[model samples]
Target: MLPLGGSHAVAEGQAVLLVAHADVTTQRLTRDTTRAIFAMRQRTWPDGQAARVFVLPNDNPVHERFVKERLAVYPHQLQLAWDRMVFSGTGQAPDRVRHQAEMLERIATTPGAMGYLEREYLDDRIQVISMD
Candidate 1:
């Protein structure tokens, strides 16, 4: 088992969650911007390119970790925000994938796509976005 607070622990990685996309840009996103993107509040990156956000189900552990640790928000809060956005016609929810492989596939193929992943599941197809 992974050691408590180990270098590989999910919690530890969650704090510095790797946000990757298919684009070649070396843009490092600010924390607020990252939060805005995931919260569906921001539609474009700093470069003005449309940002396509992907995510796993709300109940998934990695999803929970990402929301809580990376975004500094709770899953339920994010869900409520998403609901408000969709119902208000101001924004739409992110594309959802069932697992890491699917998330990887979507982000790697889709343009301006962004999503968080554990380091081990990461590969070359996706470009990492650093959080400011």
Candidate 2:
């Protein structure tokens, strides 16, 4: 878990960047598509490439901020959605990494990957997908 009160510090213009493997062709995502992919309802990008989603633990400050600020959904609500999809056998849960470093590594190496991170963690190895 992140330190107490750490999430408050993320409010100063630190929007989450939606990043993917550099080779992925898709460059942008609609708000509804982003929501569905993160919710474990959408398995592929609009261009028909597989969407590989990564995330930190639910209790992590970054995860909380990304869901609430970027997705406009609460953590618990997203968790419930994932659970429903997994149980119904219609979808699988996103890959879970322990921290931002691991998330960055996974996104950089995995093809079709998608994950959110702070601007400081981004690099040329990953392509930033604009949220439309």
Considering every candidate listed, which one attains the maximal lDDT? 2
lDDT of each: 0.80, 0.87
After TM-score superposition, what is the CA distance of residue 129 in candidate 2 from its true location, in Å? 0.7
Residue 46 accuracy (lDDT) in model 1: 86
Per-candidate clash tally: 0, 0
Report the CA-based lDDT of candidate 2 relative to the real structure: 0.87
Best model number under TM-score: 2
User: Candidate 2: minimum summed lDDT over ten consecutive residues — where?
Assistant: 1-10
lDDT of 1 by residue, 1-132 (tens): 444243334533433355567673746977788899899988888888888999999988889988877788999999999999999999899999999889888888988889878767888888777766
- Model 2 residue 9 lDDT score: 48
Off by over 4 Å in 2: 1-13
